[model samples]
Target: MNINDLFLCPICRNIPLSERESFLNGLNYHLKTYKKGAFIARQEDPVEALYLLLSGSVKTEMISDAGTVLNIEIIKAPKPLAPAFLFAENNRFPVDVIALEACEVVFLPKKSVMLQLSSNEAFLRGYMAFNSNRTNFLSERIKLLSIKTIKGKLAQYILSRARGNYFTFEINQTQLAEYFGIARPSLARSLSEMLEDKIITFKKNEGEILNMNALKELVVS
Candidate 1:
């Protein structure tokens, strides 16, 4: 990807050409490509640079002590990976990032990133907003993890993602189980139970909430 296109990314969105040129001046950056299933970065690796995904998608995941894989998030192209962690004290990746398809990434050194943050108000604000959104997402993840029962977790998941009475899943049940940190069978059973109880109707990736009140009760119960 051309360095000029980096300005199109959310962190640099709407930045004036003058400011963009100013941000790029003397900046040492590298672009690297990865094949599908390649590990872009390993867990606990030092975040020496800001990783900007220029193309393709990747999954952020962590393996549990019991050897279970937890799916953290799927990030698409044109976004920075863990923007908030770039300047963190520990400054290490919390999860492994693996490419879901052929991907191109630009690595901007910490110094360059800091320069952009200090020199461009727009870039700084965009960076802060991106991190704030990630914080909110983590808070919701924590809420889901706190729900002890599989049914309850599934209920909360459905409630959060549903649009009116209808919804569609981006990931399959296996991936959903990983996200919920539960056994696949457990999640499957809960879905079956919900269907049998007329609380929801799920088929393939699409679903409908048959009993919205029941789902609400399940979430709080």
Candidate 2:
């Protein structure tokens, strides 16, 4: 992997090349690899470093007291891991980050990250923007979890992404089921019901809203 590419990750984007190189010069960092199914960091682990994924993907999941696993999100390479938690009062991993596949990551001690935040204006701006977006994402997740039915969750999701009466799905049903904490069959059944009710019409990877009012009602109800 190109070392310079590390400077292009989400938290480092828009930073001037010279300044990025300067900050990286003599920087203390560690590179680590994880195999598929490996737990990179378990819940409650200290947030001692800024983890920048260099390759592959991972899923952030939380296990409930009843041993149920709630999949929070899937993060691919070229992104920071739980950046918003880095400086929180409870500076610890809130979810278990497990490798979805073989992966490599760069670990920069929080002290070094703080130094970068202080010295690099662009870096600071990028960091803040990333965290702000993360906050919004979490808020949406909470809203999704609050909905009582799978149909309601599906309606909210589709309506959020729909452009006018048309929309495209980014992930397949299987992945989406995991993200929604439901079984594949259940999601498929809900979707079939929606189609049968004429609330939506579907094609491969895309759909058209046949009854916008119905979708909105499902979400609100």
Candidate 3:
């Protein structure tokens, strides 16, 4: 990806070409590519340059003491990784970022960030608005991860996407298992339990909610 691709990101949206060029010139930004399974940023790494994903996918993960890894988010291309952390007191990455596939990223130095923040009112406003949404997204993700049981996690996921009494899964079971931080067999077993309880019926990719109230109860209780 090239510098032109920066326009696709919300933070770079509507930024004037002259200001953009100056920002790039100040930092001497370069696009770097990483292969699959490469670590973009490790947990606790000091945050200096802001990384923007230009293409492919990256996963943010948190590893537990027991060696369990929970994938917190799968961020697709054409977006900034963590703009809010730029001004943080600790200024460190909280999660490990790895390339799920071949990917490209660009970074801008902290000096350039401060330069634009002080001079460009429009850019400053857009940057802040972008991080505000990020804060809310992180809050919701925290709630999702707080659910302890597999059934509860599955219930919350299903209810979030359910259209009335119907739900359809676009992702396959493997991806679902990875997202829920569970083994495929465990996910399959809990799903079978839901089927046995007659709370939901699913075949292939689509499912219909037979007992929405019961599914809701499963989430809270």
Candidate 4:
């Protein structure tokens, strides 16, 4: 699909890129399709381009020296993550990005992005705001990972999804395991415990939400 037709700037879903011609035209950009499970870029690789996901999902991960793969974050459709080159000090990617499904991405060269940002105040503001939000998200994820118990982590995750009085979304066991950085069996045990405690509910093929007040109590107490 043409970048213009996509309309939604995958990085900032609420903003349409068609309105940002100065930013779009200044960059040497190309649209590329990636197959499911394709590696978009590896950890420590030079940051040459900023990618905007046009379709599908991607996961960011890092492998430790002990060969343990730590799943850093998952990028859903219509959002972008880890545009490392926008920062002067981030010359290389700190984690690997892999397509979770067949996807299309628009790649904008780093040099062009820097040039455009230098001359366009509006684009600069938008880019800065994006990075600021990213910083806050990373901070929260770090805090979540620091929680020692599986139940505590699960409680935090559910609390994050709770909006007003409702909480529901699609997620599978494998995805949950990846997000929690634990084995599937361990996640299963934790999930079962939560269900038994009446902290949350779920069904096969359907995702889950929480007993919000119960979840909050678990999180605090």
Candidate 5:
């Protein structure tokens, strides 16, 4: 994608021409590419620049006290993350971002972005709305992780994927365990239980949804 097309304001997916010009004028930002598995940013890194994913995928993660990497979220192409932190009082990144595939990104200096936001009402409003949505998403994720039982967590996860559809996204057992912050064996046992209960079924390398209603009941029970 052209860098212009990729220029999504973190607060709003689209950037108005006036706002875009103002941003470009303030920050001498440029697009750069990173290979898969490359570290885009490290935790607690100085909030130097804001990042916008132009192409490919990225994952945000944090290291726990025990030094285990806890995956936070997977970001797809054309999405923006982490710019919100620049405007926050902390001005520090809470998690690390890694490229999951060959990725292209746009980076703008924090000072430049803030300058533009201060003078631009439109950009400021978009920025605030974006942060609000991000906060809500994080709140829901916290709720998901609060479930006591592995089976309950898995059920809720599967139901979330199904959402009114019969197809669920394919994810390997290892990835599932990592995403849920559970041990491999515990995740395996939970999956077996879910399969036995007819809540879900799986193909060799794909996901299948058996009963969404039953999965919801399992999550709540």
Candidate 6:
């Protein structure tokens, strides 16, 4: 699909690129497809350019020194993938990006990125706004990780997503464990403990808050 014909991306959505012919001409962008489990970018690799998810999805994987692999987040299409580091001093990827399925990505070169920044005021503004939102997201993720107990982590996760006392987690137990960066047995044990303590009442995908005040206290303390 044509880059200018498309909505561009979240950064360029408000400021359409189709109208800016001169700005559009300065950069080169093309599509690339990757098979499932293929590494789009390895950990510690230099940030080459902006990547917009054209179709399908990808995940960010973080590995500890002890080889503990934690899958951080899944990014869906039409969104920029980790462009915050593109302008950093080191400008290296902190995680390994892997395609979850057969995915298509909009790959922009570094030269194009530089040219867009120099020539397009709207692109620059949009890029800055994107980075600012990314900062907030990272800050919240750090806060979630900082909670020491399993119950605390679970509580935070539910609280973050729940509209009321009721919330439905789409991921199964195994996926939940991986998302929480803990073992399956440990996650199950914690949930069981929470149930016994009357902190939450869960059945399969759906769960209701039994003691929201306690959960809130758990998150902060």
Per-residue lDDT tens digits for candidate 2, residues 1-221, read 66676776887878887786787864588889999999999999999998999899999999888989877888998999998889999999999999999998898899998888898888899999999998997798788889989999999999989999999999999988876778999999999999999999987879999999999999878
Q: Against the true structure, candidate 1 has what lDDT?
A: 0.88
After superposition, candidate 1 runs with Cα above 4 Å error: 16-19, 35-39, 61-74
In terms of lDDT, the poorest run of 10 residues in model 2 is 18-27
Best of the candidates, TM-score: 2
Cα-lDDT of candidate 2: 0.89
Q: Scored by CA lDDT, what does every candidate get?
A: 0.88, 0.89, 0.85, 0.73, 0.76, 0.82
Report the poorest 10 consecutive residues by lDDT, candidate 6.
1-10
RMSD to true structure for each model, in Å: 3.0, 2.0, 3.6, 3.8, 4.1, 3.5
Q: Tell me the TM-score of each prediction against the true structure.
A: 0.81, 0.90, 0.74, 0.73, 0.69, 0.74
| Runs of candidate 4 exceeding 4 Å displacement | 12-19, 33-38, 56-59, 71-78, 99-103, 118-122, 200-217
As a whole number from 0 to 100, the lDDT of residue 172 in candidate 3 is 93
Which rank order by TM-score, best down to worst?
2, 1, 6, 3, 4, 5
What tens-digit string does per-residue lDDT give for candidate 3 at 1-221? 57788778788777787677775566556679999999999988998987889899999998877889867878898888877787899998888999999999998888887887788776788799999888786675567678888898889889988999999987898888876767999999999999999999999989999998999988887
Candidates 1 and 2 compared: the better one by lDDT is 2
Global Cα lDDT for candidate 5: 0.76
lDDT for 61 (candidate 4): 90
Candidate 6 residue lDDT tens string, 71-110: 7888877788888878789999889999999888887888
Best by lDDT: 2
Q: What TM-score would candidate 1 get against the native?
A: 0.81
Clashing pairs in 4: none
63-155: candidate 5 lDDT, tens digit per residue: 987999877878887777686777668877889999999999888777767786787776678777878888886776677789877888887
